[model samples]
Target: MDVRLLAASAAFALVSSITPGPNNLMLASSGLAFGFRRTLPLLLGVQAGFQCLLLAVAAGLGVVFQRHAEVQWALKLVGAAYLLYLAHGLWRSSSTGSAAMDRPIGFFKAAAFQVLNPKAWMMCLSAVGAYTLAGAAYWPSVWRLVALFFVLGLPSITLWAVFGSAFRAAFQNPETARRVGRALAVVTGASCLLVLL
Candidate 1:
């Protein structure tokens, strides 16, 4: 395995995992609404799901996506729709102290959500295509990249959840929490537009 490629893949994984996307945004909302302890399962679920995705991409799933443009478009459509649905839920929870607002997304649900996350797909495809070498070194390089992502992604995403949790004190007031939740909802919705574009 090339050291340079490994380093590059590490950097890519860190940047992509830490950046605001559907996963991080949802995690932040979960942290703010439910606290970090409750959000830990969701965070772990994302890592599990993303590592699986990376493995799948490394194992030729990326080839299928590259060959099927319509499939890619369909995924984007579904992902955008799902994001919109989640944004609506967040928006609704902002106004009412309902049971739904008290519920944070669970491990299985969060893991399943990765299948519909366009950002996750893009990250996997790009990493597998750009970082891994061919021939005898292929599997080794792929494994290295996966390990790198797993190690780096966890803390990067944790930071988002932690950041949201930090605001819990400030958002102790119901009105303030509502406003922040609504803002997060708007941002989440806007991310859907980006996915579509």
Candidate 2:
């Protein structure tokens, strides 16, 4: 891989990973509700899931997506529905502070969620297409991009979680927490628009 291309890929990974999407939004919400330590599993899961996604895209999954518009549409519909469901749950939990809110998203669940995350798909597809080389150098280049993303992305996503956790103290009051939770839920639900687009 060219050093310049690798550096550009690193910047892409950092920006994409840290941006406010479903994963980061959920991570922040989880951090606020569960604190950083409790949210660590979800954080790790996002990284693991995204890496798997990037690998798959590098290995030709992007071709499958391109060839089958129906499949992509199906994924989009399902992803949008799932995000709506999660948004509802978040909204409800904010109002009642339900037992469901007490439990954070687990590692496996978060990992699996990548399959339905449109942003993850976009990031993986874009990264693989843009950063990789052809033929003999392809695998090596892909690996480099993967490692770069893994290194840069960790701290980027971690910042989102930390940002949310930082607000935990201020949101301790029931009313304040509920208001914040509801707002987060709205944003989460709105993210589904990105999926459909």
Candidate 3:
């Protein structure tokens, strides 16, 4: 890839990775409820799943979407439904006595979440479309795009969790924690509006 193009791609990856989208909102909520360490699986899942999605898009999933327009439409519907489901779950979150006993979106589940995450899909598709070079070096370019996202994404998303964890002390109170959970639910639910758009 050309130097200017690579730089532009990196910038896009950074902005998209760090922005307050569905993943970031959920990660922040998870961090507030479960703490940083407990939220690791969710983080890992997002990265792994998004990497796979980017690879698939790079390998011609975009073309498939072009050929079968209905497929994209169907995927969008499914994605929207999943977002609504997640929003409902967040809105109804109950206070857990123990972090260990509480299951906050596990590794495999989080990874699978990417399929339903419209933001994740958009990021992957945009990355592949904007970065991957045509010809022999295409795969390499895709890998680099993945690297750019991974390197930026892991840290970018982590910051949201860290920000949430900063309020861990305030959440020590049970009543306060419940309110926080409700607030997070609102935020998470609002993030799902993007899917509707």
Write the residue-wise lDDT of candidate 3 on 1-197 in tens digits.
Answer: 49998899989999999998777877887787778898899889988988888887777776787688677777777877765666566556534533312577888988887877778878887888778888898888888898898888889988988887788788788777777766776666676566767
Give candidate 3's total backbone clashes.
0
lDDT of 2 at 193: 92
* Candidate 3, residue 25: how far the Cα is off, in Å: 1.7
lDDT of 2: 0.88
Q: List the residue pairs that clash in candidate 2.
A: none
Q: What are the models' TM-scores?
A: 0.95, 0.95, 0.88
RMSD (Å) of each candidate, 1 decimal = 1.3, 1.3, 2.5
lDDT for each residue of candidate 2 in 103-181, tens digit (9 for 90 to 100): 9998999999999888899899899988888989999999998898888999999999999899989678888888888
Candidate 2: worst-modelled 10 consecutive residues by lDDT: 93-102
